[model samples]
Target: MERPSSNGDCYLSLHNFKQGGLVYRDYLFTKDSLMVFNSFGDGPISQSTGAREYYFFPRKNVIPQFSWNSSDRRLEVTATDGNVVFFDYETTAMTAASNLLAK
Candidate 1:
């Protein structure tokens, strides 16, 4: 959907699907292009990308480094200011236990 900004500028509104509730990602239109927060990340990661080393760490480790190893075919991830993590391209863990399963 489209909406007008309070400053008289126009912006494009976006919606995101989340587990508990919906998320919104609004895009501001500029003269050249539309600018939006990269909530997801800079871009997609792969063996050639995430699987490799990254020198550009976030200011406060808020943005962790992720990579894929073509040799091992595994994904390597680093937590914010913590130990490194790896996944064998298997199922992802749930954020929290479902209420239906809880007392």
Candidate 2:
């Protein structure tokens, strides 16, 4: 939300917040996959977040795509290897609750 760098280059850190832990994020960019994380203070804690990942598929014949199944409240992804992955989301209201109930 803020930039705490001296030269105003680091766009990840907070303005006045001095965070000394790991931070990372992953999102689908224009490329196949792109993610970045940076650690400003303390030792190299960024590595603790997770290992960096990169995925690139040949755009010749394989077309990896994603679609949202609104009826099932899921986002399905078809990979280049013909593998399929579905991410189901909870769209119910707070009062409606979810399958996870308290003991």
Candidate 3:
């Protein structure tokens, strides 16, 4: 079966399978590109990218540096004021203010 397209001011649910997973498409920081995080049974599964490193600043942890290691596939949240939090990308949940970056 085919799904009907939205004419103009129509809206679709975030969980709409036809339109794809929940989209943060217009999310402020995500304006550059679409960053889709796959939610696992428990929560977020993992983040995948072909880059050397990625960085971010979780809304709650926005105080030193937010960087990730692509080789090891890890996520690091840091503050500009010098606070830091680290986690393995393949094993951590998505942060509230997480921002994706290129190598």
Worst 10 residues of 3 by lDDT: 24-33
TM-score of each: 0.29, 0.36, 0.26
Task: Encode model 1's per-residue lDDT on 1-103: one tens digit a residue.
Answer: 3455687654333333331322223323222232333233344433112211222222234434456667865555443433344445333211221111111
- lDDT (0 to 1) per candidate: 0.36, 0.37, 0.34
Q: In model 3, what is the error at residue 73, expressed in angstroms?
A: 1.5
Which residue runs of candidate 1 sit more than 4 Å off their true CA positions? 1-60, 90-103
lDDT of 3 by residue, 1-103 (tens): 1122354221111222333444322111120122233332333434421212223433332223346679867655443323343444543533334333344
Decoy 3 TM-score against native? 0.26
- Kindly indicate the candidate among 1 and 3 with the higher lDDT: 1
C-alpha lDDT (0 to 100) for residue 50 of candidate 2: 48
Q: Can you give the lDDT of residue 60 in candidate 3?
A: 39
lDDT of 2 at 95: 22
lDDT of 3: 0.34
Candidate 2, RMSD to the unseen true structure: 12.8
Specify the poorest-scoring 10-residue window by lDDT in model 1: 94-103
